[model samples]
Target: MTFQPLEQALHEAIDWMLRLEHLPASDPAHLAFEHWHAHCAENRLAWQRVNGVLDSALANLQGLPGQAQVASRALRALANPPRRQLLGKGLALLLLGAGSVSVLNRLAPVADLLADARTATGERKTLQLADGSRLSLNARSAADIRFDTQQRRVVLRAGDLQVQVEPDLARPLIVATAHGEVRALGTRFMVRQESERCLVSVQQHSVLLSTADGSARRVEAGQAFAFDRRGSMAVAPSMRTRDDWVHGRIEARDEPLGELVEALRPYYGGLLRISPQAAQVRVFGTFLVDDIERTLASLGETLPIRVDTLGFWLTRIDVK
Candidate 1:
């Protein structure tokens, strides 16, 4: 299912809500909002959904003194031009609260919703394909499966995957990302799609890694490779710990703190921000992916860093 239209509708509904918040029923914008709400069924549904979330959030705040004033202040802050870029982030923190399913729905990528297989935040899923191959998806991951008489393909939309291929010379298994493809020559391997590159780790046998530019390299078992559309390079062997997420843990071998934070983001329900200096801090240890707070607390104890958490909505890490 494609969520593009619905996503657009939801965004428009939010815009309308913000606009109408300070406008009277007699305002010209009210007429425009009415037209937009009546434009289509999707608009109506999005409006209802957005209002439902806001109502729930308001109810949650009802116990506080001057609840109406608090909400009004938050909405007005969101309307500021300087803070416009933070509209989503601010709302997620101040109004939506933490771990709101509505927030997740708004933040999730359209491609993820349309994927043939996907896992939600902090969730892992395993699948046995029609060809007897086993596939494991990491947190916040998505992929599309395409199988035919000719080839077996899994397109990684985002995040990481580990697969144990069923031997079939007749139909080669290939994992593709925006950067390139990893053709499994043997069985077990892992693939991760990063912002600017794709990472491949071979666990059982060798796989042929190819870039979008037609460059190719053979990555042997126990080796890891990283590549973008332009070129490829060998990553540190220890980096193969990329698949460690499958075990609900991360084994950082003197890795940068930013890498560890990136790994933890998918598992975290709300915003997790780290300063550049803190991110550069070298980390070496094992951390649990499922328990973000505990892991972060452990890090804070061991590293020269400060961790500030605002309920469950946000956690900010900085160099101490």
Candidate 2:
């Protein structure tokens, strides 16, 4: 998502335009939005390119109607409403659906129809990787998977990994992580390429985790754990399933506060400051990791702690 300075300025202006919704029309938000739009050739070019406002509106109305209804209603709104109301709602929707519209049309070579997915810092994602097998990448991670006849492979450009495998008679899927590699031969597993180590866990089928040094381990299902540059450790039942966070929940059996907070960081952005006062709090319930603000509110209710906002979506925990 590289952007030129003009593009960046345009993005900032778009934010102001959207924020105008909270102010009185007399405040001149629309006027400001227009002024910025006409600031220079570059500004206008950037404004024409940023169509995120439209993307958001369309995403919000995904199942209700297609883009045609939206286009017609927008024209209709411009025709029927007062100058103020029409500009307010119509401009917002117009901007939302129009993100990168011109840029996309011009840069046709760079279009991605695949809903590009992302993982935040310390955030991980586990998804069924086409072959009925599953792959999970650690926080600050990304991978593009494609399954073909020759082999099923995952190219892990960054982050730690843990995988669960479903075998196919054709070829065992291989994981290529930064540290090294792991090849599965009918196995259930977890593999994490931590800062220095590539941990591999085999839950049911067999998996071979061969390090760069030529050392290897064959792990089994229910026997779950990690491996790195140092060595392999005992597989614990507790580490067997940390897969729930992606689906919006984390069911813990007395996990530590630090671990819980680390698990919750990806669902929310910005600093999630956990005061040392909560360093040792033991959590043992299922948490809704999705609506992180609501999760924080829930934490405030269940524990003697308060979630105080520090803006920029930053939050801190204080003893209630």
Candidate 3:
């Protein structure tokens, strides 16, 4: 079975689960759900798969911190029409045994959905701004565009973006993140928001990288920089591979397996778990971002690791 069909079935099953959660047994929706479930074998399988995990998880919910709050928030979000789809995706991942409630909470794409521009998992998008600048978002990325007479800014809410400035001297183009801001001095550059730090790679001219603190640094063409809220510093120029995602590829040169897995997660639809020992293994290669299974197979062939997949929703990499 293809992953897409199963994924769609799971999503539909989740939608039905939410709708029927508070409804009475005689609710009209129950009959409709029964019809839908009987419509195909995949639907029956998906319903069973979801309920199997949900039943087990719910049995232990009391022992799990914040599970109740997470469930409440998910239900509340589902009640909001505009947020239903995004919340459904998050909830499906949660009930499918992806992670802890806290982890799933953080993985929820609420902020991404509210951004001016965003891309779904395994999807990429490019936008032509009002200022004639070009902004390209990597998979699962989100950014808000703000334009004014004084300045033009893109607030990157998540993931990575490559921006090509139109060069309006009247208003500088700045890309902001939790760590700091990248003021485009030249033409093009890329900024990635990581958990603890922000990464900037200049492809055209230069960018003025400023941290949340007062410090600033000039990142010239072909250079890369990384910073946290507290400080900033230059990184290896080889960090240019950071933009490889723009082309649906990951170019890893002696990169840690964990970092590579992190890059792959946004492109993969399911939860990808890696053991610490497997994560520390060094990798060097170019892999397609979209063909996750093929990439994993290649890694398994070349690296000392075991890749195990559970249906279409979970994959684990462990040291062999």
Candidate 4:
């Protein structure tokens, strides 16, 4: 069928883009790419279509107020990965050709770039709001803070944040996400936005959580809760230990290898693949954020796993 042929072409186009995205202009790959691009009219058309989609997405992101510079830098980084390859790992292999458009839609790269405050991959930032409240963002996080006479609100567009509310009885402090809103009642809490739900962990005082459907609950201190548009779920006792990332490390406590790999993804500027067996293996340790390669090597040494590295932007974990 025509659909089958077009799908194959799209897959090929995606593969080609990934290969050439991080390659140097003078590399032999470019010569090969040029030949491939000019080989047939269909190939040319596919290339043009792919490029058009990326350009349009980039342009749309750049149009956001005060986001032009950040979006340009982010897009350029995606195009030309760094030689050290720190945090640019996820998109290349996972998002192939038209798939890139879908990834863009899900991640909302423009919204993150345009956020009032944002932290790049493997980077954390602390901000002091106008109301004297403290906001700490985790790596690869984005938040928009809007303060007016009516309320002090922070919209968590992506990732996680820890907020220490400054007591202001006149104006309530609220944190909003895709799932719902958490109203701070002189509380300190952390909100992490996962795929379909948001996790709210209250550390001090209590927070009033309201779902999209008008259901509400007061999450007290020492509790961790998750909620989506539908409603809030059961609450669990809070962890006595703090998030290790706050201390510039990742602490894995009998965690699946895949979970650790995902946690490390934001710090790696490469494509990483974990075999099914490798992902199922359990790991526990503290990995220094700055030494990701060493951490991976340690995994290979201690477990029945192999860490395979191919060039600056490719790594794979397979069963030994």
Per residue, candidate 2 scores C-alpha lDDT tens digits across 167-212 of 7768778876666567888775555545565555555667776656
Show model 2 residue runs off by greater than 4 Å: 1-140, 144-150, 159-166, 235-241, 318-320
The 0-to-1 C-alpha lDDT of every candidate, in the order given, reads 0.76, 0.55, 0.77, 0.72
- Of the candidates shown, which would achieve the greatest lDDT relative to the real structure? 3
lDDT tens digits by residue: candidate 4, 178-292:
9999999998988988898988988899999999999999988878888999998865532212355666787877878888898777556455799998899988778876566
lDDT of 1 by residue, 148-206 (tens): 98889999998899999999998889999999999999679999988888899988988
Best by TM-score: 3
In model 1, the worst 10-residue window by lDDT is 78-87
Candidate 4 Cα outliers beyond 4 Å, as residue runs: 1-68, 73-111, 235-242
**In model 3, how large is the Cα lDDT of residue 176?**
95
TM-score for model 1?
0.69
Worst 10 residues of 2 by lDDT: 104-113
Q: Tell me the TM-score of each prediction against the true structure.
A: 0.69, 0.57, 0.71, 0.68
Which scores greater on lDDT, model 2 or model 4? 4
Better structure of 1 and 3 per TM-score = 3
Q: RMSD of model 3, in Å? A: 7.5
Clash-forming residue pairs, model 4: 85-269, 86-268, 86-269, 87-269, 88-269
